[model samples]
Target: MSEALPQHLHSAAYFGEQRDFWWNHDYVALLARRLALDAVIDALDVGCGVGHWGRVLLPHMPRATLIGVDRERAWVAEAAARAAPFAPRATYRVGDASALPFDDASFDLVTCQTVLIHVPDVPAVLREMMRVLRPGGLLLAAEPNNLADAMNVGSARHLAPVDDRLAVVRLQMVCERGKIALGEGDNSVGEVLPGLVAAAGFAEVTCWLSDRAQMLVAPYAAPDQAAMRDDALTHYDNGHCIWSRDDTLRYYLAGGGLADGFERAWSLARDAQRADVEALRAGTYHTAGGGVQHVVAARRPQR
Candidate 1:
């Protein structure tokens, strides 16, 4: 069985509770082996949210001294506390991603998961990661083309009416464009990170797809399925879509969604998610909503 989702405080309400359903051990092990992760002596997890990425990767790199940094003090404290059981020497600090608080060439591995999508200046963040990484150090990031994932309508098992699925997809596309246009951040940064990494002077840039899949089948026996149900419940309780309704609305309006269309689009999307939850309860729901996250890795130049 996979590890339970950490019960740590999350800074973002929408994604606060979701966990290892996507970034499981097998996937991390693959990345570790492919990238020679065991060779890393010092690894820095930038924007480490409760140290989930570190927790998943550290066991594979036994010699690594893990360092987790997040802007949220709560996350920093939680990461430190959680890592104490096995990684006693691990450290956690409050810091920014674009301006990492670390010395040049301080670590053999500098990485982040799902963090770059939220940063406006992704190149700056990559440059900082490069700066802190030692010669021949690895810079790895797991980001997603979130818009593509959002457009996956899933099989008929999850969709109540297939016709309306396209509408929801279009709505999401609009919101994504709006989100980017607002100078907030690009939600689809994963697809473009290879270029960004190469542009940042990193060599041997490569990308891989995360092997973990978020397929939810009937009876909901798996821990992942249970977690999904719980997540949907949380979203419902908070009156949020997969992303928060407030944030989605802002993005939608920014993406050129007419004020008049907001209610209809939101209603359709919310009802669809609600249907999915109901299907789960009825033991009829199934979906492969697992995002295709891009693991973009590159090596810093030898100094």
Candidate 2:
């Protein structure tokens, strides 16, 4: 959903820190509107890392009782603590996506953000969510096609050759392929979820693009921009140029990237990202990075 995750990945350090830049309040409202929150009573948030998505959607559904589930106990604890102030009726528990620890036909709404993209058997997870949904209950999954992020257009400090751009793209493709080949989840699962939802026999399947973008301008006074600045700096400190360089390299090599070309490709991509960061510091950076992020919603058929 948010990032492509390998099966072997365990650390939750980076996931817990990202916020405000991508899934902003306006975009959350857009998604909540699409879900049509008129009758939701009990809702489930799958893979709720730190409950960001649940918190964002909570204000829109005043009557809804939220229960968040994650595989990590630490995240569950963090989610509960973070949500306690505003979401009194909310609860968090450690659970897995393929086997939610809930009764069938229990929830009025079942949702996830960027969760399905990390699943190994996406259809199985969808079926499981549907099974737990009350008849006609809504199912919403927000996911992104991250390969688009690799070639995302933005104002660059230097004009590089087309070939250089192509090399970066190629490098990304290799890394993505490697991530999946190594049994890691797909980072670009958003583009495929509509069909998956329909195939699972959910009725009235629909999709909408997230209205969010990586828009940054001079002075960067907007609240979202300020959040983005903080997020970018945090990412830089964590050595993440898209995904972390360490993770990307592991996937790249697993996906069959030549050992010899890794340095040049990685250097080029990092330099490009660093250039944007420098421009941001100088108050001259402007970019609107778009990706194939989709909020696909469907409903279980009434019994």
Candidate 3:
């Protein structure tokens, strides 16, 4: 599995861009507040993709330590790259979510973000998280869902190159913002986190919903809409295939079947992209872009 993770992450566009965004943004700082990091001296971020949070937490935790674990090595590499700037203050390694590589009572806090939905055994993963933290340690989890709205699909061929181009543009923009690309995995957060965390024997847990997405594109403004469209398609195709075993990701990437179905639909994608951009420019998409943020927090029993 370790040998394969690198290919999955590097070739997989989904993680690549997310790592870029995490490294570039303050998303980690925002995450720590939910975890109450000021009180946590050491933290283990389970399934810490690309380890962006480590950099943010290192400075905030003062003399504390931070470690990140992930199934994907390239992501670990990306996380390492981001953490390198922070030096000995932070470190990350390739580790399994189902069975973490750590000793009992190894950490003061265990954090995982949006990882429950992706793993095969949620309870097992939670148990592993619980096992590593000292008694009274904090458990912080935030997993967001991917709900799609105002989305349209169209063929990449037949229509004028501009229209085919626009179809890819809208798909990429909407999916990226929703983090729909990251996936809800297979189940809803409402159904997954509470039951799993409770079963792991956490005494207390808190939940939160967040909605924060803001991006739009009008195809007409792009100088080479065609080139941009191809890039978007390639990225969407590559990313979709890597993280998901779902045939849909592989199907679109394959490209043979979709062209037949959406030949007439290309124009609709352009229309969708144009309308969304216009609404965004007119300040009409405020309600449309945001979605719920689900956060689950737990406190371990006092030792």
Candidate 4:
């Protein structure tokens, strides 16, 4: 029911899709450290893929137990392998956040990172987090603030929406034929998360900003790839003809050969960001980073 993993909804475990850095980024690490997770053990990550976040967290909590859970069995297997060194200390499981198979008060820290947007039911997931967490446990939920600066639209106003490269124009024409889940909120899932966390009944809701852009060159900066990676880039290199230049062409031709096609225009927007990679990191590229995460924490209404 949740939207298919928006960040990399297209594919998963596709040779380390988002985990190519995913939650294992340096900034995310610093952010996690700032969260002071060391105070608690037996933490769980819903929607954990490849168990990469543990790379940063486990080392931080050498003495605490950590577990990563996901709906994908294959990813769970990979996550298990990644966390094997920790073994009993760290565990991986194939589970759904909406229906976790854990007993009440099973975890002292329950964390969800950029996982809610992909999911359809935010409240259901929040309740589940509460269900598994101990009475006084911490619920650490992190998502992007795509619409964080909604009022800043006028302040940072630029040129009117004229078709500059004819790319956007063409893409719009193509979109008329098929469904493209387009919306300011849709484009960037994490933009306005503070309000959502508040609504979720999370208290002590503290928020922080995270900048996750790679600054320059390959991976994060290389313009077109979903994100960056050392070995995860083979997908783009080998499938360039199939998914790159040719991929856009296929979408266009399939849509009556509209020169200004949707895929092509979207690619243009990515290209535009690459040109100003600085801006991309400067909070221009919403959704991924450059915003505040409410990271709300609340109790289960102790009785």
TM-score to native of every candidate shown: 0.91, 0.90, 0.63, 0.63
Question: Which lDDT tens digits does candidate 4 get at residues 1-303?
Answer: 122333233224243444444343566557557767667778888887766655556766656788888888766776777677778887888898889989988988888666775565677788888888887777766665433422121211234244543444444344322211221112134555556666767666666654543232323444323453322234434333113454445444555655654455657644433433433345343232223443444444454
TM-score of 2: 0.90
Best by TM-score: 1
After aligning candidate 4 to the native by TM-score, how far in Å is the CA of 37 from where it should be? 1.6
Tens digits of per-residue lDDT, candidate 2, 92-169, equal 999999999999999989999888877788899999999999999999888989888767746763366788788778
TM-score of candidate 1 against the unseen true structure: 0.91
For residues 1-303, write the lDDT of model 3, one tens digit per residue.
123345444224444333333221355556566566777777898888876456545766766778899887777776777777676767789999888999988899888765775665677788888889899888877665443322222221224456555555443333333332344233234445776688779978777654334222443233333333343445444433212333333333343335444434444544444543444445343221333346687877775
Separate clash counts for every candidate: 1, 2, 3, 12
**Alpha-carbon runs more than 4 Å astray in model 4:** 1-34, 145-187, 217-303
What's the distance in Å from true for residue 1, model 3?
A: 23
Q: Distance from true position, residue 191, model 2, in Å?
A: 0.6
Task: Give me the overall lDDT of model 4.
Answer: 0.55
RMSD of each: 3.2, 3.7, 8.5, 8.4
| lDDT scores of the candidates, listed in order | 0.81, 0.81, 0.57, 0.55
Q: Ten-residue segment with the worst summed lDDT in candidate 3?
A: 149-158
